[model samples]
Target chain A: MLSEFRNPISFARRSTANRRTVALIAGLVATLALAGCHKKVKAAPPPPPPAPSAPAPTASITATPDTITVGQSTVLSWHTTDATSASIEGLGPVPTSGTRTVSPTESTDFNLTATGDGGTANATAHVTVNTAPAAPMAESNLTEQQFEENVKPVFFDFDSYSIRPDAQSVVAQDASFLNQHPNVNVVIGGYCDDRGSIEYNLALGENRANAAKQALVNAGVSPNRLRTVSYGKEKQFCTEENESCWQQNRRAQFTMDQ
Target chain B: MMNGKKQPLYLLLLVCFLLLVITPALRAQDWVHTGTNLGVQHIRVAVASFKPLNNNAQTLPLKSIFDQTLFNDLKNAGIFDMVSPSMIPPEMPGSPSEIHLNLWSAAPANAAMVVFGNIAANNGQITVQGFLFDAKNPTTPQILGKQYSDLANDEATRMIAHRFADEIISRLGGGINGICETHIYFVSNRTGHKEIWVMDYDGQDAHQITHLGDVALSPRVSPDNTRIAFSALGRDGWAIRMYSLTLHRLVYFRAPVGNSFSPAWTSDGTKLAFSASGPSGNNEIYTIGANGGDLHRITAFRGPDVSPVWNPKTNSQIAWVSGRTGLPQIYIMNSDGSGIQRMTDGGYAVSPSWSPSGQFLAFAWNRHYGPGVLGGQDIYVMDIASKRWIEVTHGAGNNDFPSWSPDTRHIVFQRDNQIWTMLSDGTDQQQLTHIGQNIMPNWSWK
Candidate 1:
């Protein structure tokens, strides 16, 4: 019945319209016929629900000053979002977001990594380091003989390796000279007067050298710059049997290590 | 019946006569035994120069060497009061029929015993006839008679003299063997390097043993006299090195880690106890096999432990020097590293050498050790059981490294860069080396 009513209205419309209006009425009647074929209409089922997802992790790191001189330190700041764990190269493990002070002896790149259930994120901060200037060539241009002369030998009492009061001042001066000439490494030779057992004197001579070396270290000289050896009574500065000669023989003499 | 009774009587008479003759012979063999101990009364002895039997060119020289060696040996015996050669009669007895015993028994020659010998050299061969007589017993004075034949040389003649002198010493000075045939091993730098050297007991025929251009110290000859164990500095630092005297080369010795010094041998010549800084970098006493295995650490305490010497008589105990109690002192312990005892109470004492008899320890000590101490270093010998010590060397240019002669009656040590020897009681101090600095003298075991 609806199709019959639509056909009559379309016929009445077509009789008063031109061919274009009649073609439009024919298309409208065909749409009505197609709509009338469905007896009942129902809403389409909603699309499958989207999967649950975790947010991606983010990481950022920055050094307060990316450039530094040798022996200088820099502060590194970093932040991470949705991160369960974070770590920086050379700094080991760290809090998710924090700052740290690092003193690198050389230029280095500090890399930060943030890890979470979602994935991993990486960030890096490059630090530029300039080496300290070389020690002055004039200070390092000392000949071995000159070095020995500048660093006078220290003496010890008979049968004792303890640094005498007079020798203490000499040791301090030696240490000061050594510190100034940073490139000069020295070998301390301990000697003894020709009195006592050879073996015992050897040991005593070693003690003397060690005592002098320790004094130098105490006076702020780097221990790595000094070495010790014991000549005992094998090599003597003087062969006389008197006290003056013996005093000369019993000493801790310094020489430049090649 | 009459013949059998007569035979029994004859047998009894013969037995009585044999006993009468044998008893006096046994009594004559008995000698007064004396030693280096205190309160020993020395026997007065006279040694006449050995008469040269032939006028061959080698005869006089060999005879002189023999005569001098004999006199020196008797003098160094420490059990004899030697009569001056000038006091003896001019008549040199070459045979029993030529001597006047009464002359020796009387006057300035007031000798209780007399030693005389005659030497002859013929065609590069030498013969010596030595005799010892009891001057007090004029009728039966012959106590010893020996004949020695060897090649005509100074060394052979001296050796013959040593044998004869040793015979007399054995009969009169107790049954101890003489050290005349022994050698003294020492370190000398005369060759521009501290090398091991050896010389006769009487400071004769000194020669270098090791040619190791490196520094070598403290040469201890094994008891067998076939090897010398010493400390030497090498590319790998100080290590205990072995030199074979028989093979004339450096033998294989497992170099233990660290600086090893002062290698001493046990009496059996199968092990050596030395001081080495092991992995701990502290000096400790360790023992290893002579052929190099079974390394065992004997000391575990702190401080430097060095100069180990075995009680040669037992080979079960060791005497060493340790700085554990501050300043080195003499210490003794079992070979198995137990029952440690400090032998020295105080002061600096080191280089302990055990006497062959195992009753005394000879060491170098500075009793008043410290800055400005009045006394210098001296050699001391202490009785192990009594702990009583006697200063053997006093104010003698820093004497040290005292080594005991095999006979236990003499000690050879270093004094003022020279090798010296003295009696155990500190008498007869004689310098053995004069050319170069010689130190750390060790007497051969034999």
Candidate 2:
């Protein structure tokens, strides 16, 4: 072992082998053997242990199917290197590497922090939560649907709130439907064609709605089950500037009300 | 690195050099005081951009808002021939010592009046020092100097600017009060419901006033500006409703016998005149106390009579629309429904709004209103004494519901689906709303 330590110095003197070169090689070998003897003598006292140093912890996270609808959920998978503990932002302490199912009501960012003796590392995974479209009424509850299908809207003539003969029959049918469904309350929305002044049209539309309600009251339907509101020419059902479109807009629409 | 270190010093030196060079030249120049008296002729005014006094994050933005609002208010004052910003000197004079009369009174600017100010913000508060100068006078150029301090916010900054502009207007535009501080209440369907909404007279900072998820129309603010009298559709059908602005909730207004529409507040704020149908199914003009009692029928006409408006100047007369003849026409009568006089000779006149001065009546008139008549509804201002009317809007998408400004110099009306304002002589027309269908704008009394 002592000769092994002196091989580097002897190789340097291989080209020149004079007395000085031989003397230098012998000196280096003697010094190396003495250092080896000194190391062996020191080994018994237990040499100081090397200082412990750790590198920074690495962390990475991913969310599978990051985008989900309102009722759906997403999975967040994470992995960490050289971390003693790890935790997500919303969730408490978890394993160093694991998967978690998260269902956030809104858009959220999940942050993961991994801590170790060396350092702390962070990784973030963004999950986009989209609000689902408004759910339709339940299949068993068909009050609104029945109102739309059975309670027909009665049309009016130009500048006239008087229910026409044809509109009379339609109003009668509507009243009959309301009488049949006594549990349902209905709001009669009076609308007008996009003509005339807003204030005047509001008054005219109210007159039409009241006339319709009066007809229903005359037909055995309780007046308490009916309410009237005038839309006037404000919210138009048809925007086309034509006679047919105006006729379609000038009507008393029936709607289910709470 | 060396240049960056000395840059501020260089800037200071340059500023010193400019002041030394400009101050003596300004002092030595001839100062001519051009006499432009108010009410005689339009004064030529120059509005310099407000100087930002500091580098705070809120300073520049607040200054910009103040600058724009003040400029627009002065431009819309209807009595000033405003100088173009390009013609005026680029230098903004923040104080009396900084203003140069020769620079403003000379060639390109040729302004008789100059308005300048400086704005600063620190520690959540803003300070504004505004000045109006007679640009012609060198020794005594200051016309009006005012200072305002308020919370550091866009709204407060805007209000400070408005107050400053009103002061300038009141000083320069004869004795008429500025309408900049007024509000315009109208109907907007922006929130998917026709709710009453209010905004500044120049149409800024619009917000909903009522959360009644139904149709509300004809918002007439009380003379005191404490409540709004309007008609809303509710469970009992169309009824006149009162909303207390200070209370931020609906107050009680007893419904008359039939459906009530178009509630018009008297200038005294004691009563509201409206039109409602009776048992005969014909709408008639009716008056009720502001506290919702003492309902009385003012008109017992045979045909439909609706849309009543009290003469604000003299609360003894009212102008309303009557269909007693073949078509609707504007009529003026006494408060007790006597002394009936037809204002329009022919052709569909409705929605009469008496001017604050009681000299003119602004109404929506379709002179050629007939089948295939080839004309649309337009707004007209009529001299009540001579019945001589001037058409304010021509062929602009069926304009209607013209409400006179409190100043009597401007009119707000609904054209198509948006609310608009223009001078009484049909100039400087501006579209106020762009979001949704807005209609029936009523100017505040104050």
Leading candidate by lDDT: 2
Q: Residue B391 in candidate 1 has what lDDT? A: 80
Off by over 4 Å in 2: A1-154, A162-190, A209-231, A234-237, A251-258, B1-40, B372-374
Per-residue lDDT for B352-436 in model 1, tens only?
9999999999999876575445566888888999886778777568878999998899999988779999998888899989998
DockQ of each: 0.03, 0.09
> What's the lDDT for residue A31 in model 2?
100
TM-score of chain B of 2: 0.90
Candidate 1 Cα RMSD after full superposition onto the native fold (Å): 29.9
Q: In order, how many clashes per candidate?
A: 0, 0
For DockQ, the strongest prediction is 2
Which candidate gets the maximum TM-score versus the true structure? 1
TM-score of chain A of 1: 0.55
